[model samples]
Target: MRFPKILLIPVLTLLITACQTGYHLTNQGYSRVQVDSLAASADSGMARFLQPYNQQLGQTMNEVLVESAVPLNKARPESALNNLLADAMLQYGQQKLGQPVDCSHLNYGGIRTNLPQGPIRIGNIYEVMPFDNQLTLLTLKGSMLREFFEYFIGNQAEENALIVGGVRVTIKNNLLTSIEFTNGKTFDPNQNYTVLVSDYIANRGGGTAFLKDAVRRQDFPVTIRDVFIDYFRQLGKSGKPINPTTDGRITIQ
Candidate 1:
């Protein structure tokens, strides 16, 4: 999340220009301006104007939220980073709803970067989950839930397209052979279960159109980034470092 000094010049120029323009300007054809060594020496006013804002942004982004015991990287089927995010969503959902959540999930593509093994900063979380996707709660019959996974299994390519928590899935030959809840409860097609997912998926983004048919759905004002921040802060408060590990939540044979 480190902002390069060179990139900041163009951004600062835009900001200064915007501030100077008293009226809205219509967009027109744009051309790239080279920001080489010559351009670097040309703008003392812009540099002065950008200094404070840049410093403030840097301070905020660099604030340490928590520490990670191990480098959390994303991987197909299952990985420590995926497990950590899914588990965070599940725990946060349960706390927010004041009830047990059956499961939680996030699209693998949503994770943009990996966290290093040491201090996790606010910027790191922002880099990891850049989308402003909000958390959404959905209630679906077990049958509908099965359809959700079926779509995932059928559509997934070389990469693991999904990360899930509180549910174990066994896939073989591109088929979902079995699914079990970690709570030791049976998945009954007739029974309804609560699921936590991003608003993007609930709205049928990422090829999950079946989610639009959920028996019940609720959108929260919370964003996924904020949820991770809260979770990390809570861990910091408890004197715990992030040390997530894969638990075979999703297996392929």
Candidate 2:
């Protein structure tokens, strides 16, 4: 009472200090590590369950596609899927290189798989062009074209060169006699023709030695994977189903 309200200040400060709570923090701790289940982590397990179903589904879809789509044998001269694939490569190559890509070709063996009869998928194309090869464009003159023809004939005279949109030929008695185009245009020997093709062929790995020429005038590096992707996407958009049919593109006679 002697110092009035000032006397109570010290007591209040002490009381506040005493009322504070303390946290008992610990330096050591325990952890419960979680491990993924066997089913989730094992790749073999996933493949074991999925492979059979994928094949069955592929087979059924292929059957359906074969029934509904246009047969290759009946398709117009350039309407075959193989031809279309080659054409797509040529177009892509031309756009990439800023030049006229004259023609495109693919080996029959390289077209390893066929389009299925039912629902076609990206996986189907992967099976068809499974290698990690790139698209290449070769500028060859008429003389080189003749050499290529000679080489191909020497290998398999009966089988015609599998070209896409720009060639007509007749094989006779194991000799390449007449080669023309749908437009009645003949291949000029002096004019340089830009051939859009696969890198494998350009490297002469696919049994055609003409591709081994020292002069690879220009090279456009493009992967076949991208080609197939674009092709599949277009097919899906158009709902234009395709079938595995043969044409005189590679004729026996």
Model 2 TM-score is: 0.60
lDDT for each residue of candidate 2 in 1-253, tens digit (9 for 90 to 100): 3656876899889889999997897798898777777435767888799999989877643432112264232122233666766766766665655766667766555665566555655666677778888877787877787667555555544343445646665666545566665445577778666666777778777566656663565555657766766655655665565554445554436
Model 1: lDDT to the true structure = 0.85
**What is the Cα-based lDDT of residue 64 in candidate 1?**
88
**For each candidate, C-alpha RMSD in Å?**
15.6, 17.3
Stretches > 4 Å off in candidate 1 = 1-42, 158-160
Kindly state the number of residue pairs that clash in model 2: 11
What's the number of clashes in each of the models?
0, 11
Q: Residue-wise lDDT of candidate 1 within 17-68, one digit each (tens)?
A: 9889476768769799989977777578988999999999999999888888
